[model samples]
Target: MSADVVAGWGGGEAATASGKKTLWWRDAPSARLAALGVVAFLAYLGGTWAFPLLRYYRTPLLDLGKLLDHGVRGGLLYTAAAVVCLACYGLALRIASRSGARLGVILVFALLFSATLFFSYPWGAADLFDYAVIGKVLGQYELNPYVVTGVELAGEPWVDYAPWSDTTSAYGPLWTALAGAVSRLAGKGLLANLLAFKGVALAFHWLDILLIALCLRETRPDRVAAGVLFYAWNPLVLVETLANGHNDNIMLAGMLLAVWLALRGRMLAAMLPLAGAVLTKFWGGLLFPLIIAAGLREQPRSLWRRLAYLAVAALLFGGALALGWAPFWAEGQGAWAGFRLQLFTTSWPLVARLALERWLEPARAMALAQGLALGATAAYALARAVRVRRAELTEASYGLIFFYLAFGCAWFQPWYLIWLVGLAAASWDRERLGRAALFSALGLLSYLLYHFVWFGWGLDHFSIDGFRALAMAATVLPPGALWLARGCMANR
Candidate 1:
């Protein structure tokens, strides 16, 4: 690599085999910062444990009712914790950017932090238990998760703690199957099942880190460690993937693996992981246009080669859908029919329904809004595909995907930002990285308004209360202001 690439703002070399990449505190200030990052994370963990309703209110350490009654104090404490977490994230990124952190050192830090956070409270989300319930329903009862939900498994002692008990699996089939496999191995203990699921999440988290490093190695070899650290040490990623145990990380790992393979000139092989990503989460399939564009951009491209690539990609994706989802496809229209429930239950549709209730009927308004979002996303994808080339494929793809996800989607959760973070990390777009980090940090304020009922928050029910509006503003303002400022600067 050229010196400009090697000296990418950081004095440290990228993954040197000599005396440079040592773990000693003196040689590696990044390592010391990594240790400090862990300390900050531990503090965040402790604060989450103290928060009410995030964990079971009846935990031996905390009384949920008592904590909730002190609403103002509780909210303040939670906000304080969030602020601390964001602050630490900023520090870690600053250190990583300047120190030219080694990938090995960062991985060591990521593993240590993730392992400890695994034991921490789920922290404002109950998705982990919900995953376990789906697993138990599928693995133990042999029921189709696409058709049945945690409500059907209410008889199980652990089901009481899971959220969205009334809804069927919101994810794609591969995730449910993998959850079942893990559940079966977990035996009957509720704690054991939860731990097993968390372990699976942590493993996927590590896999994503590794794939990101590999992708950056291909795209920005000199800044591989910085890119990896950018995603791996992200507070939102750690909390959402490991603590809450969301399966989005697994889907992301598959997606990044496909990108890495594609960058290495293995476009055909890339389809396999892309298929796995799609089957893991349907969002993965949305990336197909970008992949196709990258393939078409290859040198010596001809009609036949393009056709062959299209045919193989289609076959792989279709086969994955047929194989992974066939069993749970339901009667008639298959799993596709069941997915409609997901749309109606999601945040955006609900918001649209509420916003348009006075002017239009709820159902029609939701349909219109959903149609518009999908149409716009499709149009954007086509435009990107028509102009995309290998030289800027990653950057262009990330932009389109982030646009659709950030503006087109109805619900904007913190973990959703992980997709953009992973892509931005490899794309070597510092501005995009800054925006994503800011959004993720601020998006977390959504939890401040979470209203846990007799059980937990469900997709079917939500209110556009004042707190919810404040949370929405938190999600929008920072990024919006940054865009406006950039525009003003350009004009000047």
Candidate 2:
């Protein structure tokens, strides 16, 4: 594609009235869009800096809770700020999609966004605190975090802040060991440890950006800037990975690297990073079958050759897992305990359980709902896996993850959407990208239902059922309506 076409100028050339062709950067509309994106970044930065004032839990470092009086006013202010940030993110994404967007501009803005959030308090979730406590358990006390719960280390700083204090480490051994190393480097300071973990996440977040760009360049070269911007500027990704300090970015980086290598025809070399991703978080394992399918496409039509390929792939994958687990294997035999704790109902599953409770016992209702979700997810995965081609692997992975998050996941979190957004951006599927963007905005918005509506509005009669109903509507309605409208337009 020519520069003008790539820049979204539909004609042969973008020329001035003086009959001189204008450069893309010098075009009036491009400059305006760039300026608007800059303004959005600045606005988002200010909002992140202000997050400390809305902190839910008191900390010795700073206490700005009184600024909003820690009541309904505070909640409403938080809701407003979140809404503005998401709106700004959406606008910036629109600007990035224009093909006129420069990679340099996107990279600079992404770096600034990550840096600002790196210093902000994790107001959205307490997962960072849990990570710090687990790190302390393993690093400071020299205990196996996978075997010992944070609750056992009662007096440790930040232990009280962890929501899952009674559970063992839910993350994979590789993440646990990395967290321990970060904790050891940071020493005994609470703030230091927290920032250290965020710093690691920041590094991985950038790695993910690089990997996303490289993958797009390999598969969808024309969309590199737009695709990178899609994942980099996503509000949910920023808040969850950078500010909240979730390790999902690390997992994503490994997955992206695997995809990049596989796209370049190094299918065997991709298995190591794919294994690393799974060892970072179990969800990364979902892509294994997809990768295998892609690998099979590259193999010659011979039973012995395909068998040899499968054996080598499995050996690489299993060997990586074994090496990652070897250090903690002896004492961390109960690591699966943390994974089991993550199986509680939320989102769509919660809605299902609530609806079924009218006719059956509560436990039975939940069991039935979970079973149905599993069955549906398994069927979808099988169908997609069977038809996946090497070129369509990323899109297939995105579709499976999107479907699971929508209808199967028993415990859904907003950060989980990062998985879908990352793959969708790589695939560069317009409809999937649109849906991912919509879901991201809505997922962030759903926070208000918990932080404000349920608590701030003084709705004493509000129940989990009410929250589930509103969350489901907020998540499902907008995208469903958009999909229907697009179908009607196509038919017309």
Best by TM-score: 2
- Tens-digit lDDT track of model 1 for 1-492: 232433243443443344234333444555667676777767655755554233552342223323455365666666676788778767777766775554555666777668767776665467777887888888888888888877766566766677566678877888989889988899877778878888898888888877877787777776776787788778778878876677788888878888888888877777788888888777776678877778777846588877887888778767877898778887643554435633532234345555776799766776777777778778888988888766565677577767666556665566777787777777877787888788777656556555332114332253544334445555655675685577599999
lDDT of 2: 0.76
- Residue ranges of candidate 2 with Cα displaced over 4 Å: 1-25, 53-72, 330-342, 476-492
- Measured against the true structure, the TM-scores of the candidates, in listed sequence, are 0.85, 0.88
- Model 2 clash pairs? none
C-alpha lDDT score of every prediction, in listed order: 0.69, 0.76
